[model samples]
Target: MPDPGSPLARLGVSIQHLLPQRALTALAHRISTARAGWIRRPLIAGFRRLYEVDLDEAVVPASGFDSFDSFFTRALKPDARPPASVGTGLLCPCDGTLSQAGPIFEEPSGGRIVQAKGRDYSLAELLADEKAAEAFTGGRFATVYLAPYDYHRVHVPCDATLRTEIRVPGRLFSVSDATSRHIDRLFARNERMVALFDTAHGPMAVVMVAAMLVAGIETVWDAGLRLRPGRDVARIDFDPTVRLSAGAELGRFHWGSTVIVVTGRDAPDWVDGLVPGRRMRLGEALTGPRAPGRAEN
Candidate 1:
């Protein structure tokens, strides 16, 4: 658990509540989308420097990205990552720090999810749909925190068909560790996009949650998704045709955000050694290979 009385933690939470979050996000959106080299180049360079971004892993444009968004969401080299073989159950969807990972408790009201060591929140509240929340009772979940320097794109962890898309609008508080500890139901209260899918293991949810300065969220299906703030929950059902293979791109966040993956009962065990604070890479096997001796014996 984070230090409850940490002065630094309280400062961040206090600032978020006082700031004009929407207006600031709007301003950030303008700067991120600016195509002019004069506007984008300096921002990209400073960000890369500040984040110690490993440009060697990213495919930089010969000249430069027309906008910081392009650079932030730049594609990797074709051979950047190896394909995720079927043997390794689920693949990680993005590159970031593993904030939390484990089983979802079958609580009386929908279910319960862990936010921190001494913190847990309602699964139903996070999903914004009680029915949808029921499907994940007694399940597995992993929350990845994408840093500003990490790759912005998200990917499928397993073969699955999109079933529904939920747009939930709420506060834009920082998804940082400090805020996650201080903000009550941090995720359940954030503006987010919940993508439900029917995977081989069972029902799955990939929640793309927004945070401070996060301009927009985009899925491969809706590349032009212009996410807007709203009061009501909006859900859209998809046809059966929206299927994607393991490791396929799902979507991306404009700057950076968090992704919470949840699976129904009987979800495969995540690869061992996955503890909070560990850095996870996209396409890495979330499920580990069995021991050769055990398999043979």
Candidate 2:
């Protein structure tokens, strides 16, 4: 017979996990395509106020937005951030609440991600690549969650050349703390766009995770890919020759979601202080060894 403690805990987690995904998905679709000027205006107003969105920074202020999708994925002023120097160790790629940021650690391969206090999920599932997973073994990781009021575009952390891109499609679940703590393998299960960029810091990967109502995630290189909420996984690869500058706009989320940066074991040791729940911004240095040979600058 199953242990009583195990069943009870699993039940709580399961129910807690499923509720947010359903409610948020419904909410996402309704708001994203909402056409009623009156209804949509109030909804957008509420989210803007709730998330404390900075209208001054938006390229198209909230009043100019036509739909919730536009409002959610609003662009920022070109001068909002200064250009990043390639010599700096690394720069943050987005403006969001640092939901969780730290090193990826587990005793064995295919180990779990530290979702919260007692939770962990698989590396293989997160990257959706067995060989690619090994590159990040013992490396660092940072997960940033974008709220409705945040800047939606993502930038490059360092000077890197595109190697490949894999679109691992899956369910679009809400990625709130309530969901993160309860959902098993939440990141892996969610539809995500993975871009593999090879850099001097080592092979770095930026995973643009999709959440409920986040209509889709598009990159500057491949702007045509569109995704609808569903259980599916797709993979796309690119030639290894395409290189981009540090802090270059790499991708954008149709609506708010999460962005994760994964670095391999070879990354600099100075990246020791980044922890979960910390805040970050684009073009700010994160970490890199000072040595010229090991540096990407």
Candidate 1 segments whose C-alpha is farther than 4 A from its true place: 1-5, 84-88, 289-297
lDDT of 2 at 264: 80
> By summed lDDT, which 10 consecutive residues of candidate 1 come out lowest?
288-297
Model 2 Cα shift for residue 77 (angstroms): 1.1
- C-alpha TM-score for every candidate: 0.92, 0.82
User: What tens-digit string does per-residue lDDT give for candidate 1 at 1-297?
Assistant: 446459967976888899999899999999999988898889888987898877776787535678988889898886787766747379899999999988887766658888986788898999888898988877889999998989999999998999998889998998988888888889999999999999888899999999879998888887666565467888889864599988899998988989999988867777666789999989887876545454310
Q: What is the lDDT, from 0 to 100, of the residue 134 in candidate 2?
A: 79
In terms of lDDT, model 1 sits at 0.85
The sequence of per-residue lDDT tens digits that candidate 2 reaches over residues 1-297 is 233236555565466445666467667667677878987798788887787777887788678888877777677788887755547477889987777766678665554467666777777788788788877877877788887667889999888998877788777767776667667788888888888889997989899998877767878887645544335555656644678988888989888889888888776653444666667677666674445454331
In candidate 1, residue 107 scores what lDDT? 60
Measured by TM-score, the strongest candidate is 1
| Positional deviation of residue 146's Cα in model 2 after best superposition, in angstroms | 1.5
What are the runs in model 2 whose C-alpha is more than 4 Å off?
A: 1-27, 34-36, 83-86, 110-112, 228-232, 270-272, 288-297
Which residue pairs collide, candidate 2? 112-121, 113-121, 167-234, 169-232, 169-233
